[model samples]
Target: MNSVSYDAAQRITLGMKASDCRFIMDEWLHRDAPCTLTVRRAKTKGLLCVVADINPNENPDGLYFLSWCVQHLNSRVKVDIKRL
Candidate 1:
């Protein structure tokens, strides 16, 4: 939770509802394992790519928020937060 910039206040800034946030966390816990989350922009098309590697020992909720923020910023962007 502390690792991520998104929280109750940040969630409002990001235009995310409480329920939506919960859903994303749940999905992340079950689908995406928490690890290192990275967001990079493509030099050519100016698109962002979010990549997250799975770390079972890491904080799942924090990684979930990171993943959610990455995707929320650009749905079309790539995401690779899977079990390792």
Candidate 2:
């Protein structure tokens, strides 16, 4: 994808919004590659949060982690891919 599209995609996959996007972006870029991402959309608060964990023996690609998370959730809770 192009740079803007790629960044937009990443923002969606990261569950970032305009308010706190800078902090999230900073944290995401500061993280080294070969990381795993955890995306949570809380039912109670109706908030979406993304956390990246860098550990061995886990799926190392960010996109892979996103796919895995979607599979794991099994659409029980909605993952908003179109946001951002």
Predicted model with the maximum lDDT: 2
Model 1 poorest 10 in a row by lDDT: 6-15
Backbone clash total for model 1 is 0
TM-score of 1: 0.32
TM-scores of the candidates are 0.32, 0.34
Our tally of clashes for model 2 stands at: 0
Among residues 3 or more apart in sequence or in different chains, the pairs in candidate 1 whose N, CA or C atoms overlap within 3 Å are none
Model 2, 1-84: lDDT tens digits are 312123333333444343343444455456563454455654446456665433223343665544454454554433344423
Candidate 2: list runs displaced more than 4 Å: 1-9, 13-33, 36-48, 51-60, 82-84
